[model samples]
Target: MPSDSDLVTVPARARTSTTTRVAKVLGLLVLAGLVISFPSLAPDSFILSVGVVIASYAVLATSWNFVGGFTGYISLGHAAYSGLGGYGTALLITRADVNPWLAMVAAGVLVAAFAVPVGIASLRVRGASFVIVSIALVLILLLVFQSWGSFTGGSNGIRLPRPFGDDVLRPEQHERFFYLHAALLAVLLLCWWAIDRSRFGMGLKAIREDEDKAQSLGVPTFTYKLVVFVISAFFTALGGGMYALWFGFLDPIFQFSILVGSYMVLMSLLGGIRSLFGPLLGAVIVGYAMEFFKAQYGDTQAHLIAMGALLAIVVLFMPDGIIPALRGLVNRFRPQAASIREVSAAELAEQRRAAEDTGGSERGEKEEVRR
Candidate 1:
């Protein structure tokens, strides 16, 4: 639950204007510009290392956005599925000398297969129980890794000989690693965009609001949820595979760690889980927060403490996340919700005039984001 201060229950209304859409696009551009410029500014290989970690995390957060963000499933074992992808790729590559790219694809398929059973079985649980199941599911994987250490590589886990062989690629490939993450982030963001605008997304909104009501209206609630569950697992595994390759090693504890899963959830929730831009914003904010905190308070546990406090603030004062909070502040000043929904310069004029003509009580002017 969002902290009480953050939980201002803004009544839902249609966005009858174009301002919000334009703002979203502009925000994306700014974020893209910043991401592209970061590696060049920091020559230190370690900062780039952190970027890789953030990138991999961004993928998981975005993928989880499909289920937890959009469908309200609140999956907590996302990292477990991702670990499956990493370990699966590692075993196939180390044991059989398979191509890394091919190994990732195979891992994705296997996880998607595993996801079907989990989805079908877990759909019976809803809300908090559903979230708990996700956590419990990770434990099941941990036990498997521990008890079957002989086959699964135990607690010490798998290792990789860099990309092809060298631990570090040629200097020419420094930005290549960065671009790989940028591209992966693009793919995940695009998937989120596509999913949010589709018919399935409408079903998800319905499910999010009230499952019984949505099912009563003839929505195939179970099938859509299961399909998204499997799809989310597939992408998450792909990310995990990339992550393993990026680090040149893998451990079950590192791959399947709850902290990774928790951070993904926190990032999504802190940025506005239901919004399309939420995961991206959340990832960037948290990523940079970690960097800044590490710089300021890396000596002790102060960084973690500071991070916890910031999260609490988000939960308390900005329950809708920073985007919504900022949007609300902007809307309070301009009240241009109707003028901004569809994103046209002249069309916006007509919208503003219409609002004025109606005595400025444009009840539907607020741009309510669909989940």
Candidate 2:
């Protein structure tokens, strides 16, 4: 017969598992409903535009997390890939008259192709050296695009034809782009969740913990990092392409700016880089704050000042980011629950021996009675 403790623990374990599943399902449903209804609920075109920006940043931050968060590589040059995607989409649409949607996807493929060699070379380095390489990549792209005025429009920037043309009103334009960005964010989140539960994500986490140890365990650390880097570049590029379409403009200075890269890093770090939804939360906070600052202060340095202050506060008070900090608080204050204990090998062996003895005694008694 099972012990009293065993009976209690089993039911507790079952309840915990069931509770987790239900919570996840309900959370997903709530998120889906909010995203789908956001445009209609938005107060005005300006608010909707802000929503679009938040969604864009969310996508970029989430994409960055795949490599920076999961693989523990601090890549500050992701803006280069984003710029490449923007430029690729803009050039194709303006020069070749390709459909905007097709251009966006093709731009992602092009950026991924570009990432292959870069990842192979950069992934070999670690720490500061890798960071420098990443920064250099963005700088180089910025200069190249800035100088190639004939093809890239140089410092004057490239003006893109609107994806939906003049037929769409300003309000409708905001609504459409907001939904488009939301959809992209959904896709990226789905991909992140899928990878987070897979063996590949486990390998990435192993690399994050200790690359040498992971390599010794035959994790193929380089391949995994490179693959994830490429994937990150692809999605980030897509976000850039969409942004270019929405704004109908692309400037190398802004597109490939180190500031843009910093924002991505900041959003991820502020939200809890290790958590799946950390980047999204970070993006919402940072993105909306940015828009608010710009609206209040205009083109001055006020937004930058606010961002710096926010970063300092996060670093000082919530080093693990808001999500992780909040999670810790919840765990700390939540009521204690029963937990199942792990079985030891020695205990298992003893139980087996006892079962064998009981079986033998029963058999002997049966034989004796029969005789």
Candidate 3:
């Protein structure tokens, strides 16, 4: 039979876990409610349009997190997958005469299938080499699409027929796509939440901490990285396809721009890549700032400069990102979760003496029983 202390402690721990879970569920519900009500609350169509873009960025950032956040791969050309997804969807709709919605799904599947070989090759490298390979992928795709004038329209690019039809007003389209992007973000978040608590997530974190050590411990490091890489590509492609459908345009240069990939990286790093909502939080901040700068500065590179400054600030100060930094601050101030105090040599000695005395008493009691 267990001790009374054991019964008490176990129930306390269980109750803590349960309370944490309930709080998380309630928080998610509140967030979902806010997301659902965003368009209705927007002051204008332009604001609604910005909301759509923010939601889209949130989806892309979270998708990127599947690899970069979990496996610590830090891909610099995730735009390659998104570009491929957009082109695939466009081609399927134009050349194959598929329905736009169906084209998006088909494009996602095709892009995911393509990701397998790409992931296998990319996962062979690590660190800067992996980053270089990822960047090369987007560059290669960009040139390939650009040079294939007849098929891809070269620099001319291609335009998509809006999936929602011409009957929908621009503001209405923005509202609908905002919801669509939010739904996708919600799904990605749920998937990430599940993964974050699973054995697979543990393996990914092990890889992130030390890939060689993880492999030595039989974690199948390469396999785990590749799986996450592919999964990341899949969702990224879906986001790209959705964006293409909404925007009704696909310029290979813009679609595959290394800048887009950098945005995803920055967003994740800004918000706390390790946490479930880190990327989403980052997306909202980065996306709005980017859009705001662009709107205020016209076609100038002010947004780029702002982003660079933001990146520097994040790196220099909050290296752990906003969420973790805020968490640290909160923990610091919490009375019940007070910071641990250092013990002096005297204190250590006293603890040791107490433990030894307790052990001696236990032995004496046992001996007395034996007698």
Clashes of each: 11, 0, 0
Candidate 1: tens digits of C-alpha lDDT, residues 232-309:
999999888887777667877777777678778878888888887787778878887877777777758886677678
Higher-TM-score candidate among 1 and 3? 3
Better of 1 and 3 by lDDT: 3
Candidate 2 vs. true structure, TM-score? 0.87
TM-score of each: 0.80, 0.87, 0.87
**Residue 307 lDDT (model 2):** 73
Off by over 4 Å in 1: 1-26, 165-174, 294-313, 336-371
Candidate number of the best lDDT? 2
Alpha-carbon lDDT of model 3: 0.87
